[model samples]
Target: MSNIDIRHAHSLPPEQARQAVQDVADKLADRFGMVTGWSGNTLNFSRSGVDGHINVAPSELHVTAKLGFLLSTMKGPIEAEIRRVLDERFT
Candidate 1:
C-alpha cells in the first residue's frame, strides 16, 4: 500500500510516545476484525479478518509513530483497507 498523509501533530517527550501510539491502537480496535495487542516494543493490529497485521512503533521525541502493515498474499485491495481503517478510526 502507498503512504497516506494524516494531519495533526504536537511535541511530545520520549516517555509519552508509548501512550500516544496506544491511543491510535485503541481507535483501530473499533474496526471489524481489528484486534489490538501489544508486545514489549511493538503494538500489533490485526485486520482483514486476521489476514494481515499492522505494526505500530513510536519513536522517541516524535508526535507520531511510523506505522507499517504486513499484507497477506491473499489480501486484495490493500490500500483501501488501510485507508478505510485509518480514516474511520485513526483520523
Candidate 2:
C-alpha cells in the first residue's frame, strides 16, 4: 500500500471549508465511484482501491489516503488531481 498525506492552508471559514471539502468529495464520487460521508469535521471516502479522509478546519485542510496495490502505481496522478482540486477550491 502507498500513503498520501497533504496539508493545505486556507483562509475560508469553517463552514465554507467544509462545503469546499464536500464539493470535492462530490466530484470524486461522481468521477471515481467513491463513497463519502462526514464524521465531525472529517470527510471520509473509500472505494475498492482507495480509502481516505479530508479533515477540515478553519485555516487548513488535511488529506490522507491509502492506496491499494493497483492504485499505488498511479499515485502521482491521483495526488496531482487532489492537489489541483484543493488548489481550485481552497486557494
Candidate 3:
C-alpha cells in the first residue's frame, strides 16, 4: 500500500474551510465514485482502491490516504491531483 499525507494551511474560517472540504468531497464523489461522510470535523472518503480522511481545523487541513496495490502505482498522479485541488481551494 502507498500512503499520501498532505498538510495545507488556510486562512478561511472553520466553517468555510469545512464547506470547502465538503465541496471537494462532492467533486471527488462525482468524478471517482467515492463515498464520503462527515464525522465531526473530519471528512472520510473511500472507493474501491482508496481510503482517506481529511481532518479540518481552523487554520489547516490534513489529508491522509492509503492506496491499495493497484492504485499505488498511480500515486504520483493522484497525489498531484490532490495537491492541485488543495492549492486551488485552500491557498
Top lDDT: which candidate number?
A: 3
Compute the lDDT of residue 5 as modeled in candidate 2: 100
**Models ranked on TM-score:** 3, 2, 1
For model 2, state the Cα shift of residue 28 in Å.
Answer: 1.0
The lDDT ranking, best first, is 3, 2, 1
Lowest-lDDT window of 10 residues in candidate 2?
A: 16-25
Each model's number of backbone clashes?
0, 0, 0
Q: Better model by lDDT, 1 or 2?
A: 2
Q: Candidate 2 at residue 8, lDDT?
A: 96
* lDDT (C-alpha) at residue 42 in model 1: 56
Q: What tens-digit string does per-residue lDDT give for candidate 3 at 1-91?
A: 9999999999999999999999999999999999999999999999999999999998899999999999999999999999999999998
Which residues of candidate 1, in runs, are more than 4 Å off?
1-11, 49-91
Error of 1 at 23 (Å): 0.8
Candidate 2 wrongly placed segments (more than 4 Å)? none
lDDT for each residue of candidate 1 in 6-78, tens digit (9 for 90 to 100): 3333345534655656776676676454677766645666555342333333322112222344443424464
Task: Indicate which candidate wins on TM-score.
Answer: 3
User: TM-scores of the models, in the given order?
Assistant: 0.42, 0.97, 0.97
TM-score of 3: 0.97
